[model samples]
Target: MSLSRLVQRLRHAALCAAVGLMAAVPAAHAQSDADAGAFPAKPLRFIVPYPPGGPLDLMARALGEKVRASLGQPVIIENRAGAGGNIGADVAAKAAPDGYTLVMGAVATHAINPWLYASLPYDPIKDFAPITLVAAVPNVLVMNKEFAQANGIASVADLIAYGKRHPGRLNYGSGGNGSAGHLAGELLKARAGLDALHVPYQGAAPAQLALLSGQSDFMFDNLAAAAPLIRDGKVQALAVTTLARSSLLADVPTIDESGVPGFDLGTWFGVFATGGTPEPVVQKLNQAYVQALRQPDIVDRLRVMGSQAQPLSAQDFARMVAAEKEKYREIVKLSGASIN
Candidate 1:
């Protein structure tokens, strides 16, 4: 054979060997897909980026109890709270894309924290695959019952007027800097053109305590946690932070209806796995959580907690997360909030 033909034959043999080798071992990519196909074949670790007893932890525990039954594996709850949920979220983000690790991602984890921290440990959009939105609860603008009565504040309008009159004297407390409560207060301030001071506490419970102790005049707090206080007459609900009235609190009007037209804000909890998790795994998770939410006991318990179970498909949930992320970005800009 000529030299050129010999060189061509050698290249053909090399290409055949490469193809055989490629067919022989599909290492990194094939294993994960195989694992996902048999997803949750073993116990899964569920991370809640908050301490036990908080709403996120409670929701995870509630859903985990049911999902584990369907998954046929224990769903272990791990609390990794810190850095406004960034610590735990980063852990989830950096975790193996194997289908075993999941996180109960909250508004802070997937939406607000990215904007609040100048250098976030995780990328909300890039680091995780949204399984589904678990639930959304309204936030109620509330004040100490005695404080409202003493100040003669009867409604959203009254509160705004009082703030205007008192200017910086009206103080509001929040779970922490850039928390939903803080942003709600800032939103109200911008919409109503009131002058008020923002006080940040360690957590929602502490912020509510500040209100009860009269250290702060008011706060926008989760209806689930604040509803009992409102019902027991410890705190008075001024208006809910939603465009529409919360079904659990029908008697209370929405901020849009009360005085601030077009006002709407609320908190959401969702499930997410590391970004490259197999889509099949994500769909499986979405189905489990959706079915879990539909359980009568879960529905009843959520209602009692002042929230409703929202079961959306993975696609729909992704759209919701995207919109919320945009909304939070705007709010963070408007409020000029940053952890740095």
Candidate 2:
């Protein structure tokens, strides 16, 4: 064939190939849109970064049961407890962004741990998409009954007076160095201008035991866990750590009201997915969980456990997380809590 004719034929073939590729792009986008429309075709894995029987684990199960019916798929709860909830959070953070995998992230996992740990596997703010803030349980300031009686400590003022009179005489116990309870104690010491020793235990249960055995002077404990003891007169409830008094212990005063103004801290958890999950999927998940939280049964159950179901929009929850992260940075430094 002539050279000019051959060149023309090659150009025509190349143009046809380009046209075919252009046509395929729209088809690919349509497939993607279809897949998104049919989200959650399989079981959803909800990771609770704590062991069984804990508040986070129980809440995860409750939410899973509720969301399953709405989403038309099983919401399986997985307990991936370790490293102050970092393990499970990392798992969800690294999961595919299709929104099938979720995590029940807590103050420890997302807010406190980011500041407490020297190095972390996941970026608390950047690694996950916030769905909604689920609930918050207050921590109560309790004293051993005998100790309180001996020290003449009836109110937060009395306790502060006693601590001032005998600096370094008051020692408190907590779950560990960087746990919420520990930070609470440190924050109290700083705000109240009191000197005290901190005793770290293996877990909250052990720390509560120490308090009961009179091995430690006082500690900040979860209201639900401390309720039975308070009811049985095992410990004296001084004040609640949150700004508002708990309905379960309506008689108890808040730390802010007691003496320290603007004092507010609690154990809160929320739902999160991989950072890049589609906005529509995140909204679907948020709506389902928020609906679950609003149920009368769920609200009543959480209230009995000294918690309140707080369902915020995804954007609002993200703002809360960022504020909490910054707040805890100061607290962690004040406590000098760190892990390598």
Best by TM-score: 2
| Local accuracy by lDDT, each model | 0.83, 0.88
Error of 2 at 55 (Å): 1.3
Per-residue lDDT of 1-340 in model 2, one digit per residue for the tens? 2112222354466467768789686776576566569778899999998899887788889989999998999999999989999999999999999999999998899889998999999999999999998877789999989999997999988988999999879999999999988999999999998678999999999999999999998999999999999999999999998877899999999998999987888888899999999987887888899999999988988998897788877776787788788888888999999999
In candidate 2, list every pair of residues with a backbone clash: none
* The best candidate in terms of lDDT: 2
Off by over 4 Å in 2: 1-36
List clash counts for every candidate, in order: 0, 0
lDDT tens readout by residue for model 1, 205-278: 99999899999989998898888888888988999987667778899998888878778787778899898888
Off by over 4 Å in 1: 1-36
